[model samples]
Target chain A: MNPFSYARASDVADAIRQIAADPAARFVAGGTNLIDLMKYDVEHPARLIDISQLPLKSIEETPEGGLLIGAMVPNSDLAYHPLIEQRYPLLASAILAGASQQLRNMASTGGNLLQRTRCFYFYDVVTPCNKRKPGSGCSAISGVNRINAILGTSDACIATHPSDMCVALAALDARVHVAGPGGARTVAFPDFHRLPGATPERDTNLESDEIITGIEIPAKGFNANYSYLKIRDRLSYAFALVSVAAALELEGDTIKEARLALGGVAHKPWRDPAAEAAMRGQHAGESAFTKAADLLLQGAQGYGHNNFKIGLARRAIVRTLSQAARGMPQSQSVKKIR
Target chain B: MAQPGTAEPLRQTDVLPEKIQITLTVNGTRTGLAVAPWTTLLDALRDRLDLTGTKKGCDHGQCGACTVLVDGRRINSCLTLAVMKDGAEVTTVEGLASNGTLHPLQQAFIDHDAFQCGYCTSGQICSAAGLIAEGKARTADEIRELMSGNICRCGAYPNIVAAIQQAMERS
Candidate 1:
């Protein structure tokens, strides 16, 4: 990692001021992803504004009957929090599904959203990764891409957003709260992450100067019938190969409403409101799920090594929806599909 | 306790550069040290403080060989910058024992023979300590899932889980 100057931010305004002043500076919150990138020579910042001490570690109930999670809330704490575990169990399951116990303890909420879209090449600076260097050409497009994106792909990049929590957030319709020099703004969760359309370097719509303050989700958490199913090479401590976040508001056997999102197969958490609309009023069964899966996987093309992901994603979407519909949310502990 | 020359300039130059001065309460003692911005907590414990018990397997957060308790929460020390945890209490494997008696988990590890190389033992123990404290795991399956971060190449998982179960029961 490059040597850098460190200054602890006194408050949110101070952090914004410090970052806005220097183009080469970056905020260090959990430092889980940023530090690893620095060590790999993928990211080098001249000045690191430490925001770990900032007062943003609270998880509170919003007046709108939703939840407002502070950006600095550790993944482990967020996963085990009473409100999250009880109300937003989908989010809890997603958090526990990704990484290990030690990482979840160190990683923060906002930093998880900003984690880079990566294949194996992104971690090695020696490889030609377009996401790391724009217009430099994407190696995963032609090389090994077992973990590359299948849904949203550009010639410039085909890497997937390796975040299970974001998939759940996308399904829940969460909002990202950020504070910049201009003012505070809430970005819709889907709009927060950008597709790798010729610009894979920019992962999210968040500006360099804007600091994420909190993540807000409205009242409907889909607590009764929601599931976060992560398919990976290992049972745990690995990135998802094809993960599904399925939430349904079911009236008896008929679906009242539905929210479906896919991770590890797209530049961002892949979601289509139209496909979810197709599930409404239909019986929650394999036929309804297969049609929704087909709509979600529309135009999903895959590289040579990752062509299997197309079919895997389809089956995973169906299985995950089946699990949610049966009210048997996938367990993070017992990872084997039942 | 404040050591005599520990406070000396890290660069020893007439003109001072940017090594930030901070205090870390490791185990039970509060030691003052000046560290660079990029200095990780694992390096600080092993190099500066001579607390080599916290091993550094993967400098990245992928390996749990550098697990330690910061402010009573278990986190990967290798990923944490020393400056980021300025005033925090860091409990390494060296601090697991008290007054010549090993921590119950440490004792259970020996009884179960949960390691072969023992390089990942410190991290596993520290992680297990945090896991038991979290009170979220009650069964062997839950222990296996929660302790998945600490990899044992020796494949001593069965014994490790057994050791953790005994420790949990004792606690």
Candidate 2:
């Protein structure tokens, strides 16, 4: 690893000031992702501002009937919290489906959200990847395109964001709270991650000095019937080939509302407003779920090797939505609409 | 590729840099060390304290070859800074045995033939101990999920699972 100055911050304000003092400084919480990048020579920070001691590890009820999750809360703690398990089980399930127990115990919520993609080309110093080094080129476009993005991708980069928590958060309409030299501000979960446009290097909208303070998820009626389904080649510790996080609000037999997001298929959490719009006022059946899933995958473009991902993602979304709807205690047998 | 530990010293100052003083309680004994800030907990335990039970398969966090218990919770010590943990309790594979008697997990592992190369056995044993402490090995799926971080290149997952189950049954 590269040699750098390290300082443990006593408080959140001190940590913000430390990062603001140096543009090349980075805040280290879990060190699961950043430390690996540093060792691989992909990232070389001049200074490391350690904020693990900051009092940001809490989960509490907000004033607006929502849950406020502190940024420093470990993944294991969040996944096992009683309130989270009862109210938002999808979030708990999503966190559990990521990494492993050891990594979850050490990984923090803030660090998980800020994790970079696991693109093989991006990690290899010899390969050309725009996300790792701007303007070099993206070898993933033609090489090992199986795990590359099928939506919200550009010619410059085809990498997908490797996060399960963000997929659930995006579906649940969470808000990210950030604090920096300019004070505090809140960004909607969907707006937190930026698409790979001209600047593929920038993953999120956060500034260099900004620090994530907490995330707030508003209480919704559909959360009780939420589910997260991740489809991968192996069972555990592998990135999702295609994942779906969905919440269904059923008014007897009719669908009142639906929240859906797709992961491992886009540059960010692919939340489809059209799918949500189509699912409203429709009957809770296979046709409704399949139509909504088809609407979401309408614009997905697949490479030669990744053409199967489209079908796999479509099936995953349909299955997750059907499962969410079936949680409403109805013995209804619906035909397959695919 | 450069040799694992033979990369040219980035900073060529012969005089060792200023060392941060820290006291770590390993197993049950307290040991003090003055090490560089960049030194990881894995290197501190294996190189300085002579606790070589913690292996270093991948210096990065991709492999769980350096998993250790930090105050009863499992963490990748290769990714943790030694100076960050002060007066913290750490447990490695060497700490599992007591009075020349192997721990139940170790005994079960031997009986079940859980490892082949034995290079990743230390980390696997330490990680399994921490997993049981954290109540993570409840179901077979949970055991597989919790143990996914520790990879056995020899493909000894079935025997590893059996060893953990045997230890759980004994407990």
Candidate 3:
């Protein structure tokens, strides 16, 4: 890891000021991802501003009957929080489905959103990766792309975002609170992460000077009917190959509203409001679920190694929607298909 | 690729930033150490404080061999910088036992033969200690799921879960 100076921020303002002052400075909270990147020589921060001590670790109920989760809250704490588990169980299930207990304990809510892709070539540094070094060429495009993105992928990059929590957040329409040089602003979950248009280096819309303060989930949490299904090589401690976050608000056996998001399939948590709308007012059954799945997988392009992901993602969507419709959210502790 | 712990141009800085002074209450011993900002807590424990009980299996967060309690919460010490934990209380495997009496989890691991090679035992015990404190994992499946972070390449998972269950009962 490259040597860097350490500065502990006294407050959020101090953190914003420090990061805004230095373009290369990074805010280190829950040093799970950034430290790993630094160790891999992927990131080189001139200074590490310790923002873990900042006053942002609370999970409070919003006036709008939603939950406002501080960025500093550990992934474990957030997943186990009473309000989160009761109201936003989709988010809870998604969080629990990711990484492991130890990693979730160290990973923060804010840092999880900004985590880099787990692309092999990107981390190898020796290999040619457009995300790692733009214009060097994307090795995953022709190389081993078993885990590359299928939707919204540019020719320059095909890396998928590896966050399960963000997938749920995208489905739930969570708003991200950020403090930057431009002052404080809220970014909607879909707008937070960016597609690898031509610049694969930039993963998020969040500027280098900005510090994410908290994430706010609205009142409609889809708590009654939600399921997070992550299919991976291993049952646990593995990244998802095709993960779906399905949530529905049903009127009897009819779907009143629906939200669907996919992880490990695109640069960001893949969501289609149109596909979700396709399920609205439809009976909560295979027919409606298949319609949504077909619409969601529309125009999904897959590389050689990951060609099966398109079909796999389609099946996963239907299965996840079925699970959500029955209020039988997939258990994170249990690996049972039901 | 540069593996962990092979000192290759690990200077303080390109501009030579000074070492950061931090205080850590490790297993009740309050110690002061001036370390580089990039020095991981695992390295600080083994190389500086000589707390070799906490093993460094992957040096990355992939493996939980460097698991330790930072302010009573279990985390990957390898991924955590010592400087980031400025005034924190860290408990390693060496700290788990007191008055020469092994912790319940430590004792249970031995009784259940939870380990073949003992490389990952310390981390498993420390992680189990944290798991018990959390009071979440009740069933064997829950223990297996929660303890998935600590990988035992020796295939001692059945016994490891059993040992954790025993320790949870004692706690």
Model 2, position A335, has a per-residue lDDT of 16
Give the Å error, residue A154, model 1. 0.4
Q: lDDT per prediction?
A: 0.91, 0.85, 0.91
RMSD in angstroms, all models?
5.8, 4.4, 2.7
Q: How many angstroms is residue A56 displaced in model 1 relative to the true structure, after the best TM-score fit?
A: 1.0
Off by over 4 Å in 2: A221-223, A328-338, B1-17
Which residue pairs in candidate 2 have backbone atoms (N, alpha carbon, C) closer than 3 angstroms, thus clashing? none
lDDT of 3 at A250: 94
Error of 1 at A199 (Å): 1.2
DockQ of 2: 0.39
List candidate 3 segments past 4 Å from native: B1-14
- Candidate 3 lDDT tens digits, A90-148: 99999999998889999999999999999988887777877877677888999899998
Which of candidates 1 and 2 is the stronger one according to lDDT? Answer: 1
Error in Å for residue A25 of model 3: 1.3
lDDT of 1 by residue, B1-171 (tens): 112212212222244338989999999899999998889999999999999999999898887999999998899998999999989998999998999999999999999999999999999999999999999999888999999999899999999999999999999
> Which candidate do you rate higher for DockQ, 2 or 3?
3
Candidate 3 CAPRI category: medium
Under CAPRI classification, how is model 2 graded? acceptable
Q: Give the TM-score of candidate 2.
A: 0.93
The TM-score obtained by chain A of candidate 2 when compared with the true chain A: 0.95
